[model samples]
Target: MTMNEANTYDRYQRQIILPDFGVGRQQKLMRAKVLVIGAGGLGCPVLQYLAAAGIGTIGIADDDLVSLSNLHRQVLFTVHDIGLNKAERALAVLEQLNPEIQYIAYPKRLTVENAFEIIGDYDMVVDGTDNFSSRYLINDACVLMKKPLVFGAVSRFEGQVTVFNYRDDAHDEPVNYRDLFPSPPRAGEISNCAEAGVLGVVPGILGVMMANEVIKGITGMGTLLNGRLLTYNACNNQVYELALQVNRDARVSMPADKKEFMEMDYDCLCGVGDKGFEIDYKTFSELVRAGDIAVIDVREAGEVPAFDKFDVVNIPLHQLSRELSQIQAGIVVTVCQSGQRSLVAAGELASAFGNSKKIYSLKGGVLQWPLLHKKELS
Candidate 1:
C-alpha cells in the first residue's frame, strides 16, 4: 500500500473493521460534504465526530459569539474563545481534530438571502440551531435544494432527533421538517435552552445521534431515522420513537419557489419579529430616551454590568406575575441578560395588560448591546 493509503487506513482502522462498514464506507464518508448550522451545544459534538470520522468537506455556519455560559455544553470552545465568533472558533478546533479533511467556516447568520446559496453546495445539512426562525429557514432551504437534512433539538432535560428530506430505498416519498410541524410555534409558545435551561449531556447525546444519521444517509449502512422522530429524556433515561407521516398539506405553508423563499421573512413567521414585540438595541434606546416608558430588568438580582444608564425597576421574570400591579406605565420594555427571558416577560405583560400597555422585549439583551451598537454606546 502507498504511504497515503496506509495513513488513511491507520486513521479509520477501527470502524473499517466492522462487518458492514469497511474501507468502502470509509471512502464514501471521505467523499461526502455536509453543512452544519449553529455551532452551539448540539453543533459542537456533531462537528467534532463528523470531522473525526473524516467527512471530506464540512461547513460551519453561525453568527453567534462564544460566551462563558456556552462552555458548559459547547465543548468545542474554551474560556480563551469567549467573544470569538462561534463558526470560526469551531473550525479552528475541528481542523486540529482532523487535518486531513477540509473545513469551511461561514461566520455569518444564515438569512433568507444567503441560505439557498450556502446550503446548495452541500450534499446534506444538519440543523443544530436553537431557534424556530433558523430551524424553519434551514428546513425550507434543504427542501428546496433537495438535500437531506438531519435535525436535532434540546430543551431542559429532554431532546429530539430526526432525519428529513431523505428517502431510503424502501420509501418512495421523502418527508421534511414541516411535515412534522406544519407551522412555526407562536412567540413565547416554546422556550429555548437559555430560557428553559438544559443538561450538557442532552445535546451531547443527540448530536452524536445526528452524526450517526448523517453517516447512515451517506454510506447506506444502518437504517436512517427517515420519517421517524426519536425523543430522549436524560433524567429518567427514557427513549421513545414516534413514526412521522408525510403531511401533503405541509408543503403549502412553505415558499413555492426560490423567489418566494428568498422573500419570506422567517423571523416574522416564527414569531421573532415586531409582531412579537422584539425590538433591537437601537429601538430600545430610542424608547428609553423618549421617556414615559417603564424599563423593567427581568434578569435576576445581582446580574452583572447592570443597566444603570437609565432608571429601571428590577423585576425578575418569575416574580413579574405577582408584581404586575407594580408596573403602572403605558409603555413597558423588558430587559434580560441574553434577551430570552425578556421575550417571555414581554409575552406575559402582553397577556396581563392586553391592549392597555405597549410591551416590548429588547432583542439580544444587555450582553449583546455593546457588541452590536458600540458607537451608540459611546
Candidate 2:
C-alpha cells in the first residue's frame, strides 16, 4: 500500500473500523468540501469534527468579532481571541487540529451579493447562523445552487438538526429548509442565543449532529435527515423526529434569477426591516457627541447598562406608536436590545412620518454600542 494510504488509515482508524464505513467512506470524506455559515456555537463543533474526519476542503464564514460572552458556546476560540474575527479564529484552530484539510476563512457576513458566489464553491453548506435573515438567505442560496445543506439551530435548552436539499434516491423531488419552514419567522418572534441564552452543551450536541449529516451527505454512510427534522431537548434528554413535506409556496419565495436574488432585501423580508436608514454605532456615537439627533431607546423600562448620553429618551417598542408626539427632536433614531426591535420601530416611524422627520435605526443596538464606544477610548 502507498505511504499516504497507510497514514490515513492510522489517523481515522476508529471510524474506519466500522463495518459500513471503511476505507471507501474515509476517502469520500477526504474528497468532500463543506462550508459552515457561522463560526459561533453550532459552527465550532461542526468545523472541528469535519476537519478531524478529513473533509478535503472546509470554508468558515462570519463577520462578527469574538466577545467574552461567546466563549461559553463558541468552543473554537480562546479568551485571547476576543475582538478577533470569528471565521479567521476558527480557521486557525481547525488548521492546527488537522493540517491535512484545506481551510478557507471568509471574514465577512454572508450577503446576497456574496452568498451565491461563496456557496457555489462548496459541495454542501451548513447553516449555523443564529438569526432568521441569515438562515433564510442561506437556505434560498443553497436551493438555487442545488447544494445540499446540513442545518442546525439551538435556543435556550433545545436544538434542532436536519439536512436540506437532499435528493433522496427513492423520491422524485428534493427537500429543502423551505420545505420545513416555509417562511422566515417574524422578527423578534423567536429568541436567539443572545436573547434567550442556550446552554453551552446544547450547540455542542446539535453541532455534532449537523456534522454527522454532512459526513453522511459526503460518504453516503447512512440515511441523511433529508425529509425529517430531529429536535433534542437538553433539559429532558428527549428526542423527537418530525417528517417534512415539500412546500410549493416555499419555492415561490426564492428569487427567480441571480440578479433578483442579489437584489433581495432579506432583512426587510424577514421582518428585521431595512438597512436604508440604519446607522452604525460609531457614526451614531459621533452624531450623539455633536448633539442634535433624537436618540430613542426602544427597550423596556428595566433594561440594564443604560446609555446616559445623546439626550436619550426611553420609550419601549410597544409604546413607541402612541408616544411619537413626546419626541421633540427632528432626526429620530431608535435603539433596542440587539437592533431587531429598533429596526421595526424605525420602520414604523418612517411609515408614520415619512418625509417630515429623518429616521434611523441603530444598527447593532445597545449590544454593540459599548464596543463602538470602546474603540473611541482606545
TM-score for each candidate, following the candidate numbering: 0.82, 0.76
Total clashes, candidate 1?
Answer: 0
Q: In model 1, where is the ten-residue run with the lowest total lDDT?
A: 369-378
Give a tens-digit lDDT track for model 1, residues 196-302.
Answer: 78999999999999999999999999799998999999999999999988898988889988999989999988876555688888787788778789999999899
Query: Where in model 1 is the C-alpha error above 4 Å?
Result: 1-4, 276-297, 302-315, 318-340, 348-378
Model 2 agreement with the true structure over 133-156: per-residue lDDT tens digits: 898888888878888888999889
The global Cα lDDT (0 to 1) of model 2 is 0.85
lDDT (Cα atoms) of all candidates against the true structure = 0.90, 0.85
Candidate 1, residue 101: the lDDT equals 90
How many clashing pairs does model 2 include? Answer: 0
